[model samples]
Target: MISRPYDEIKLLIENYLKKEFSTKSDLIWSKPPSVELGDISFPLFNIAKELKIKPEELSEKIIAEISFPDIVEKVNLQGGFLNLTFNRSIFVTQVLQTILEQTKYGQNSSLSSERIIVEHTSSNPTGPLHIGNFRGSVLGDVLGRLFSFLGAAVNVRYYVNDLGRQIAPLVIGYFLLKEAKYKIEEKGDLWLGKVYASMYTFLEIQQLKQKLSMLGWKIKDSSVSLYRLDDTDLKTVPEFLNSLPKENEEKDNTHKWFMKLTRIQSSLIERIPEVYEKLNKLTSSKIENLESTTNQYVKNYQEGKDKLIVEKFREVTKIALDGHVETLNLFAIFHDDFDWESDVAWSGEVQTMLAELEDKKYLRHDEKARLLKNDIIAEELGYKTKYSISYEIPDTIIINSEGITLYPCRDIVYHLHKLEKFNASQCYNVIAKMQQLPQLSVRLALYGLNRTDTADRIHHFDYEYVSLIGRKMAGREFDYVTPDELFVLAQEEIKTIIEERNYSEEEQQNIANKIAASSIKYHILKMDPQKSVAFDVKKAVDPNENSGSFLQYSYARALSILSRSSKHDINVQKILESTEKENLIIEKQAEWELVKLMEELPSILIKAAKSLRPDSVANFSYSLASSFHKFYDACPVLKAETPELIKSRVRIVFSISKCLESLFEVMGIEALEKM
Candidate 1:
């Protein structure tokens, strides 16, 4: 029921096709690079097929014949496309009227009421979050907001891997080494790396090796052998596409062992960037580093910095191969290390299922199984190479239980449990872009609804790493400042900036918040989920075209225009039809171009929500802000004295303010109360 300029434009286009060419399909509306290029573009790509004429001729003819309203400034043809520029005064007047009056200007039901749950952070409870693990937290949280704004009932939850081997070692690490504190050493980037690395020595490796030998994987064989997966046609696939093991060992492949590897990798890759940022505080190197400032703590036991410990830890990992048991923190270590009589294991009651092709039989063997997937099953279902994921049946693993031979239950349980716990509509898990195809196939093969409580649903949100340049910024390793630390630096910078500018405290805070929030959100949201980002605080905080301040100022300028006007009361539907410089502030294409931008709020909100990309909203707001600024410089509203013209411009400014306010909040940004 809501009206939009795009909606109005769509109607006009449909009518044009029907009346001019007797055609049926709607010409999709397109946006050219600049506002001057066009408000809406129609490529004759589709229409050319229906009409015998070439696209260029059709575009020129359409441009000449189209009957546009007075508010529409002019129609032009370029690059075989029809471009439009709207009259500024009318555009501004209509925009102010529509946004101010609409009950929901920028909302969409694109997702309707889909139940979605987004799980993020899921960081351990033991230590402070530190900057490394913050992206998943921010990305997931922002996606939840985007979904809600798009008309979804979204639930955001944090998963704690509390019941794991990773927890136990940390607890034991604390007990084994008391007054265990880490100090930032030198002006180097990764201050905590050496100390955290040294703590791996305390684990039991001898027992782990024996256990891995029981798991039927010899260290040497695991290190060297490769598992090759084939296509559905049994065509051999290339073997050059997998990560090599860190060493030759059965334990390296175990899920538990992988967890430790991942944890270390994540910390180094994810958290190090933020962690390394503390170095900037001593940018001049005149001040002492973190380590020199604090006394080295005494330990309960003398832990040697030696290589034997690393080897033994690797040996134990090879044996247990279960991060759940071997790499556990204190609680997980205690529970998993116990004899059967000592403790009960924790497993959720959710039942698991695997799809069985009814018509085909799976041939079972000693180490794997194979079966055929009927291509017919996906014929009408729209599952194919373009939009489909398929899995090749593997050679079955065989195991004997009580003299009865069957598939390996150990392998089955391992994959089943992990697949069943996928916490989103899409069983969302973070996979590096490098593993996209393989991981997606795994999801397709193990599809099922993961039931949650009445109010629970799964949501997936992704973000790029805050990077220094092109490389992904890992926690302290990336050497990017944490938001908390950034705040302090910002404070000092603000003091200097304010003193230089002769600005007030409020001005400093506003500028700081504008820049900081821009840096934080853009750094986290701008990249594709699968791609890792490198961070550069200086680039992120830059206030030129890309920075958040530009948008803030744009919104403030619109407000300033609105505040200065006395004639606020006016009807939105009143269309102005004038073309003078005095009236150009309202009549020029720039004015209505901004108005049309205001009209897109709900749709953009909905789109960004569905994409789970808060950056889309951030990006859109910036464009809207940019358009308004262009309007202000080219057209002077205060210069308009006619009662009708002044009233129209006032309403336009009011509408722009309302739209900006709603969007800024969604982007986790603030519209500057004053410029």
Candidate 2:
């Protein structure tokens, strides 16, 4: 509601500057440090500097030149700043009435006709989603909600990476351990995750052996069978390995040896020795042949030459995706599209993209593979190269020696398909920070192909990793907690909270599930996208903390208050109209502060939407909740001094509740009516 008046003030300033001084400058507005100072402040330093005048003089001159509108109660010059105070009673009435009149108060039509596609949570189907992956899902889902709230034609997509190298080892492990049985009821992705971990560990051991062979050191069969060697003997092996070095220095023998040792240590800590034993019992193939077989399967699947192998691979992927869907549904996430990498590969889009790049002279042959010419792309895009001390650009390989297209190549095709098929004007890929380079390469490639418009519209909504508060996670070692596990932990905490309630078992379960989902989602979304999150279950589920539960509790408390006031038979519209006439004033500081905070919602939403920062909204919600709590404590609504005062306070409470519910909806959180 205040956003409209704020924008009008900015426009008025801009027009006055252009006409009076024949100069243009950005009119930045900020809030006063305290309510007594003013409602908004504009610094005159920049304009004064440009016009070669004193800031105090310029401020006075501008205030004298511009006419004060009805909303502007007073304009005063304090030091070098111009401060404007609004008519408090009029401002409060306008803000409250706007909230009651418009259901979509904060929504703007700036991007009403624009089409947007947000691709997120494109994790490989080899395992269940860990808490780290959940960050991207929540971020993407919230972005989609925000865009939709702002009237954009939004489509959410999940890009399934079923055709990647990560899935090859998973497929091989499944084939080897198909008959293995466990008593626990495991989800398909969880089962595949165990197999992946085992296969990866076995491959690591084999690679270590191969490295030792290249160093002319042979381990006896008896030595290989042992789980651990004596510490003294193990320490001696590192010194011996360091004594040898290759002439070219390309292969650091000592470093490789230490890395291999580290892997073995990690495997032990992750209990991979037991997994390896199970894998050994299931497979009779020599370690040396594993890679070749995995490669053969990948090749045949890509070429569609072996129907049985391809079908089996698809079957496993289907099961994994089914699990993915169930997990996503727990958070109330539903995608409009689920795109597959194999579909892009088989649809000739990858081939067509390659052909176009070749025709544009952006492709070059390098080491028997087609590579994107980085120098040519850099020159064509007019990008000045700045050499970073720790960074270097490597050529993007479109196709490898084995005639299989790499992930980035497929991704470029996928992005192009998204723009054309959805008629999208903007697209956001909510991937991890690790993929920043690849995303940049794709954007550069698109620019080289004369698709600068598309390149400009593409966004990499990158975020850092999420870890446990006191624990580290290794995805390849299967040493991380899955989202399902986090959910269970959250539910346990919530169950303890509601154990003494009078609800049925079914109702308790439903409440616990909602609270659990909100707990995780709110904590992740509360952090800036660039910052790594150390997730703590206890902190997130606390009802009194700055969390989703607190927001929900505030909303529920507001509802309870409203229910108790049924005897008054309050009419919100009638109260809003009579607010000024009855002089039902905001006498308390807490009351005025709450009203002002509520007035900032529309502006906050605009900023959050423009900056693509959901953290801003999360933070704003916390502030509003805090201010409302303060008002509730200081001012009585039902037992106020006058009926008009009670009506005024009730209106404020109602607005706060509505605002919070709207925010919770956009953040993908459930606003519970009861905790």
Candidate 3:
């Protein structure tokens, strides 16, 4: 009747091995492949080789000599492995009582003394957050929750890039539209997205025309008439060019790719033609050239050469962030702190870093930029071998010849500032895998600066990209669904499923919001972080499928079972403490399987938290739900033959609901009592 049977069993085995071998061994424990084999197992292959004995001989000798405790029902030998089966009646009772007794069953003080910083979803404040950004946000939020649950003080921060290159066009467009008659009807981020796309496409179109002209081509008017300069007469390009395949199919067709830019320009105009036309017309007449103006804006803002422009940049960035916050709120994701890149720049940290690198002789000046001699630094520091990294560490540009500090350089300064400010021991940057080299460069730069301890704690929690199946999304093109739109679609799908349930409109809305958020969160977090996800909305919302909705519904059903049982007959403490072993029956395979899965919640939490993977927890939740469903179908609860058996089953259901509720809390899924 040990409360934590798993820990007790592990300790028992380790002690036996240490005493028997007269030495400590690194023992690894695992579950047997089938329930009939055993509850837990340990392999003896390595230990056998060390002792110069056959693996099977070692396993048999160890099992024969080991003292079997009351909790150990049976011990068996299979090949080089030793497996132990727990007494089912005792196991079920102890697991249930332990869960019911502990308030925070899966939480511990393992990381109580550590402070962690998680910065994610720091999408440029130039537009609405896309689904890809949302994935990072969800991952970061879950990590924060997990760390806090493990007793670490977690700071969930967002790194806002107010002074980025993307912000220049946004600032220009915002200022242009500020005095115009055009109205901003949608959210600020969405409107700003349009502003960015229109300006970017406009600049690209003009730049393309200029390049084409240099290559013996001429374009006239906004309709984009193309004529080759080598031809004797001016002529419109053949219509077949428009029917040509996209860049993916024909990468060599440079001219055709140039023609595709005009179509994007057309799409931009079609969405917001009036404002686009006004900006294009003004820039065309040289009243204000978009490219030159934006470049000047970026240069001035970066150098603090123009106070007015800096203020405007901050103002526009704030507007875009406000819109982002609004959208994130709908998904229950919020950032605890917003660290601005401009603030880091203005604090002179970037310059200080560069000066230090120069002092250390790690800085190199090329014709175009100031480079960090990472190749040289890596060799001197033995960086690649020390870190076990496989990629080539290339020399990185820290500052351009024009004296603008690059992002990776600024990023290093930012990391140092945050760690010092927050007194954090660990930092997890939830960035995409595409930026792997840049992230590694940041780490290598930290090592070059002799911040090895700090660098060791910095983790790039990289995840693969997420795209909706059958749709291609380019954030710069503004041809993608925003998080806000995705939420709307999810809610609509949930609504269509539950509209006929006869609930009040408000309740229906509440249920829809919870289920929809859970669906999206579960769908994203269920997949491994390194695996690319092709999201499907229908699959996400389907209750019959293994989804968040299914987990919630299973929890609700379990709660319903507990509610229907007579209060007198559902007392977990009395059943576990006072009931006879014969009466507390758990003979069915399904019942024992459910107990085994429920007992694993604490280990699962620890594993997921340590690995920085919410997907493991998501998979566990689904399995728990599936196991509960199987048990529900096979085992009788309220109508059992005896009150003691009914009470035992009731405790199992109660414990599962508690386990799931805690999981939902960690995953940030809303736990609805009613499905």
lDDT of residue 218 for candidate 1: 50
Candidate 2 segments whose C-alpha is farther than 4 A from its true place: 1-3, 180-184, 217-276, 285-288, 383-393, 500-502, 541-546, 567-584
The lDDT ranking, best first, is 3, 2, 1
Better model by lDDT, 1 or 2? 2
Clashes of 2: 0
Task: Record all residue pairs in model 2 with backbone atoms less than 3 Å apart, i.e. clashing.
Answer: none
Give lDDT per model, in order.
0.46, 0.77, 0.78
Query: What value of lDDT does candidate 1 attain over all alpha carbons?
Result: 0.46
TM-score of each: 0.60, 0.90, 0.91
Off by over 4 Å in 1: 15-26, 31-39, 54-90, 124-133, 176-198, 201-345, 348-442, 448-467, 470-481, 499-515, 528-531, 541-546, 560-592, 609-613, 634-646
* lDDT, candidate 3, 281-323, per-residue tens: 6445543456677788988888776889988998899988999
Better of 2 and 3 by lDDT: 3
Give the alpha carbon lDDT tens digit for every residue of 290-314 in model 1. 2221111111111213344434333
Which one is best on TM-score? Answer: 3
lDDT of 2 by residue, 310-360 (tens): 887898898888888888889887788889887777777778788889899
TM-score of candidate 2 relative to the true fold: 0.90
Model 3, C-alpha of 191: deviation from truth (Å): 1.8
Count: clashes, candidate 1: 69
